[model samples]
Target chain A: MTSTTLTPSFDEQYVATRKVATVGRVEISDVTKSYGANTVLRDVSLTIEPGQVVALIGPSGSGKSTLLRAINHLETVDRGSITVDGRYIGYERKGDTLHELREAEILRRRTQVGLVFQNFNLFPHLTAIENIIEAPVAHKRLTRDDARALAEGLLARVGLADKADHYPRQLSGGQQQRVAIARALALSPKVLLFDEPTSALDPELVGEVLDVIRGLARDGTTLVIVTHEIGFAREVADRIVFLDHGEIVEQGTPGQVLRNARHRRTRDFLAKVL
Target chain B: MSRIVAPRSETTAHAAGAATPATDADATTDDTTSASSATADAVAKSGPAGGRLDAGLRVVPVKHWGRWVLSAIVAFVILQFLWSLATNPQWQWDVFAEYFFAPSVINGLWLTLGLTVVAGVAGFVLGAVLAVFRLSKSPLLGAAAWWYIWFFRSVPLVVQILVWYNLGYLYPTLGLGTPFTTDFWIVEFPTTTLISAFAAAAIGLSLHQAAYSAEIIRAGILSVDQGQLEAAGALGLPRSIRFFRITLPQAARAIVPNAFNEIIGLVKGTSVVFIVALPELFYTVQVIYNRNQRVIPLLLVAVVWYALITTVLSIAQYYVERRYARGSVRELPPTPVQRARRWGAEQWNRLGDAHTAAAPPPPAQPEPVVTAAAAASDQYRTGGAA
Candidate 1:
């Protein structure tokens, strides 16, 4: 791989005509969530710098996906707050307190953080290009024509230019995931959250989706991915956070967590998967 | 060696041909004879080492004599039924034809169609609103919708119609005013004037249809995968767009067939309005039959009309189903006309090939070609102006 400068200014030099500079400083503060009796997150707090990639890995029922969902307000926290670029998600700061925003306002903030689900969740009724076009046009950020052109470019970026008109059911699992990646990028979200993006894919197809995510990691966007692909996580993520039983068990550089975990639970968990 | 091989091959072919009973089989006598000749030619061309195993063997299929006999009996029974219809004078074919398109009957038919259209459209719209209400997060709204469906569905349509017709007895005058008080009336009308037989029928039918439609719509909405709505939300689509663009289109796949079924039922259900004397198709026929004492023929006219209306609705349902199947199905089922056309073309090809037994069969539909992958960059970038 070429030694592309890992700087915020790199996008301006390469794809200057396409996008503006991305600002995705994520601040997660003492966030906790629960569903009835099950506590999904317990006082979870993490801050990711702009353009940094963080991979969340844990066993099932861990708070990884819940935490990722909270960033985009897909899952609301029972306590604490999440903000991207210093603006609160799902709420507006009023003096000393946080007030819950209206649905429209929350939705507005949500556009800044795009989510990709494990199942790909591509709209079956829409073609690949149309799926990408739907959000930008609905948000009134671009005209239909502009959205189409943008969609075409995104599809090409994911290597699915010819599959622009294919429905989700018509494409293979790998192609659908790529389209999903393109869809998440369509809004040029400041932050992208991927929840088990490659878990649903066949082994051979995992590389294609990982390749798309790898490309995004280098392009200066804050990404929080919940995945079991530890090798890819190690290569792409600037930091790794491991969770267990609804709490962060360990966090550090991949080498620290994977190679020399400070906690017994983290090491035991890593031993089973590795 | 050629002479010796040809004699043995011919004997085997002859024996195989004689083994089974003669029937309409895939390999006919002409094909068998051609196969023998081809085998002989191959033997002559390549000497003793030429012929493949299983060459020149005509395999006969088992004949289903029982199926043949059963089909003959069914055809005779069907013919008998048709013959009775044609020969029976009690059918009053002449009277049936005369009254079928009479102006009065046609006017009644128009009224029936008008009632169905009005009630169906109103029913579905109200039902959609009720369905949304029931599916809403607020318990108050959900219960209100639930009770509405429950009350309306429990009441018989005929009883509801009667209640509506005699609404004047329950309330002499209806008015818009302060809750539970008439003193602050903004507008008023006599219940008798507002609730005529036609109005009563429309209200009763629409309310009844709406209850069922609500359930159908609700079921359809619920049938859509939850992930679809989450995906739409993640895109930051507005609530209206989420419901209309994402949820409704997918739900329509489940809703269309049942909705159409209700509409067709409404068409037939309009006959119940005859009791109120609002002269729809069935009511008009009843009146005509009572006056002329030609009940059977007039009744037949109504039956045929109802059947015709149902046939049209069924066809529309098929097309509507095909429309919603767009993204889900790989290929849309052919329309009736397309199916007929294809069948005709097939028969034409069969006729052309009847004399040429040696011709190869036409090929099946070709598979869609998958394009080769051109490796995209491993590095992903956001869309321009995303």
Candidate 2:
């Protein structure tokens, strides 16, 4: 008759840790996305651990980038569900019925998922510090002083403390990318998504940006990077996923996947890449 | 065998000089290498020729000859028309001076300017409000704004003035003298006795100007980037602050130029108020022409004044636009000459101050020195430098 008999002994401890880690884990279940007759992602299912750095790699039109965008609800999925920190994003389920989340709700959820685009879409008019503190002050209702302090700290962390007052147009591509990363981190997001953060950068500048991202991975931040930098993936990523034609053809540790791929498509991809 | 042996000897000699070999294996290698090198050289040269040909075909510099010819034709036509007008025997200078230079017409110019200023200010404020209302999300407000714009725009200025001037006929008492009305609540019957022609003209002109100003304001607002609004929203700026601070400040650059044009239009449109006998420049000219019958000269006076006023307005508009454009442009700093003059003035002022501070000792002498320095400074301060 006692509730102690019904519950597990470590329920309290488990609940507390679960609540803490719930801030970071992103789960995608049977997620499928399509544009009219063309499907981008088909029945893609993946679970990213709280601090795991996942690299999504594939040839062009392979749906790797689409899956990353779907996780943030930038693109609506045709089927299935994506959940971040146990909260349903883009779609809500109620008593066996599912409905797409409203725009306001999606915006609220997007605050928790930070996306860094390849183009470094920093508001050109605002200074780097202004861009970094924009969301915190506006969306989170943080005081200007607090937001400024946090933004300054993040800018320093990204090695752009001196460039905080500079406009996006004045900074070099690498510096802009770093500022963008700082801007994303200012929100204290649960997950950071990088959409080829260095693909648009000059070859000489690419290494510096990749270094910042690698440093982020080391700090145990949950990251989903869609990238062409296979070397970075091999070195920093906890799990490397190879996608092909809207399907996850193979996924494993970088060594098992990059060097000893079992699937023929993965083998062919590695063969060409190596 | 004899024929093959002679060719092989020639090939072997060619290979031996290159220090490879003179064997049959070398012979086949030499043949393949010679053929492939010749093919590659031909292809490389041919590829560039095609590219060069395409480049040559694509190179078409713009020609200004057609524009030059069109401009010359237009100039000739304008000159011919002006020549006819100048040579006409019917050009009456005396008649022009009698009506155009009349004192009444001068007063009309002042009246015209005053009316335009009043109407333009009222219309612009009303128009801005209507534009904001039209852009609002509430259906009722949007519909009301649209309806107001439509109604005002559809009616002619002359008709509006006539209706307002004659409003006394519609409501004899001006609805102010009901028996039950308290002294505070009572409305006076000013429509019949107090409604002047100037009042009617202002009301009519302001209503018409408001409609056009609304369109200009709406276009300016729409020209702003959506990202700016989003950025402001993200900053958590309140709705009103976001609009006035972020959105309107940016839109000012676009809005100012058009608003200037509308002001000039309002000034010219004031001439239409002559129908209501508001005694504006054109109406004053009409009065002179009525007495003297100097039709052409009187009309010319009004035309000249309008041109002069418009020219001044245009210059003012240019400076205002330049000021607003500083938001985007990186202006050059003042020249060294300007800086030097500024420094000289400052030094002179300091000297004057020192002299004044030593006052009672040599008051008269320092006064003269200060005057001399000021005169010198005044000479250098030409072109409104200050």
Top-TM-score structure, candidate number: 1
* Best candidate according to DockQ: 1
When summed lDDT is taken over every stretch of 10 residues in candidate 1 chain B, the lowest stretch is: B370-379
All candidates: CA RMSD (Å)? 11.7, 17.4
Give a tens-digit lDDT track for model 1, residues B119-192.
Answer: 89989999999999999999999999999999998998899999999999988999888997875369899999
Write one digit per residue (lDDT tens) for candidate 1, span A128-180: 99999999999999999999999999888888889999998999898999899
Per-candidate TM-score, chain A? 0.92, 0.89
lDDT of 2 by residue, B1-386 (tens): 34443443344334333433324334444444555434333323333223222211233355899899999999999999899777875657666666565677778888889888988998989999999999999999899999999999899888998998898888555554546653425555557576788888888888888988998888888988775654343323455656765667667778898998889888878988878777888878778778877677778888888899899998888677665554353343554567799999999999999988786655545677777887887878863443
A122-194: candidate 2 lDDT, tens digit per residue: 6655678988876777665589899999998888777777877887777889888888888888877789999
Residue clash pairs of candidate 2: A138-B234, A138-B235, A138-B236, B96-B297, B176-B187
By lDDT, the best candidate is 1
Error of 2 at B113 (Å): 7.7
